[model samples]
Target: MSADNEIVELKSHNSNFILNIFTDDYKKAIDNIKQKFERGSLLKDISVINSINAKDLNIIDIQRIKDFLKTELNIDYKEKKIIKKNTKEPKKEILKENIPKVVKADILEDDNYKTKIIKSPLRSGASVSYDGNILVIGDVNAGAELIASGSIIVLGVLRGFANAGAKGDKKAMVIANKIVATQLRIAEFIAIPPKDDKKSYSGVQMALIKEKGIEIQQVN
Candidate 1:
């Protein structure tokens, strides 16, 4: 579902799809819907919020799944709005450490400042967003998405979709310990991992958007 408060999960039966009802307020919601949308077409495709669990089914089609929301749930599919990004270097930070006698300060600054650390696995249909850099010490699972205004670093496998410098900054970079994502985006460019490399990508890899295109490289 495109609505902010609702989510749609699909069930698979060969090529056909099954509908299930799942809602916080089932009676009120279904009554309201019946009085409004279904009043026109009693047999029209309708939303059935499953009282059962959503985790037990296998979803196959994203479009058909979305259609149920529009016809049955009154959910509007909003178009993604793209915004321009700034490339100016961000402010600085100095860390001071005093161990016994000496004083130490480490400078940290970049186009976008701050770092967010994620410690859990990103499941399908879930998304994470940050204003600065991101460091995920967990897996970015398929269908999950990560969006950052600055750089992004995934210390574990990245098999989902990710967007770095989502505000339009091309200077942003993404570093990961493993690469398995179907596609990665930097600014307006997109890159897909090579099909020839099914050997389970390991080590360090980095990607950036250039005049040529999205380029992946070893982080060495």
Candidate 2:
């Protein structure tokens, strides 16, 4: 412990700390952390350890925590794990939304890939980056982002930013039920939604690199 009430050093060399939040006074805890950081007594890379009492925290609370850590403390927001005292297995809580599903498939003898599925609305200011393909079953609200090395499939509306083929795979594409995003990137090409606000379009659309430019066309 660094004399801070809620922060305790996990090790000397590591800057990470076990942020112990015992009470539901989340605002108080954040203020304490901010004060400690301003005084140069606290550092980044925090593993928020909360008591079972704090388990009832909703998505708003979780987002607030993340935002405070980033804007106030300048933390990169590494990892957040909760360990309820006396629990057999430490519950893996997914702060804003539920945990994503990972699926592995063997498409060919040398082709094995993974897919991550998100089943909740991706809120503004939230970002989801995956190494493999990404499937979102909910809306990608404005100010949110999704970046994937492989193809990105949004079963719901994609109103935010999306970057596919992040690793230079030009064949990768972004598919969405409805796309009204301000920006979309595929491989090295970037594009914005039509400025004319043309309302004529099909139910589904796909974005990909066409002739070295990002193109969005109705999906047949």
The top-ranked prediction according to TM-score is 1
Cα lDDT tens digits for candidate 1, 115-182? 77676778899877776666676778889988876777776778888887654457777777667786
When superposed on Cα atoms, how far off is each prediction in RMSD?
13.2, 11.6
Q: After aligning candidate 1 to the native by TM-score, how far in Å is the CA of 96 from where it should be?
A: 16
What C-alpha lDDT values do all the predictions have?
A: 0.57, 0.60
Model 1 sits at a Cα RMSD from the real structure of 13.2
Give candidate 2's error at residue 142 in angstroms. 0.4
Deviation from native of the Cα of residue 198 in model 2, angstroms: 9.2
What's the lDDT for residue 85 in model 1? Answer: 88
Candidate 2 Cα misplacement greater than 4 A, ranges: 1-112, 195-202
Task: State the local distance difference test value for candidate 1.
Answer: 0.57
What's the lDDT for candidate 2? 0.60
Question: Model 1, residue 54: displacement in angstroms?
Answer: 34
Write candidate 2's Cα lDDT for 1-220 as tens digits.
2355453223332434444444455686577667766665444444332211234343234445555665665653333233345524322323343222211121111132356778888989988887767778788998998887677878778889887765446677787767888688775467897542646555567787788588887854
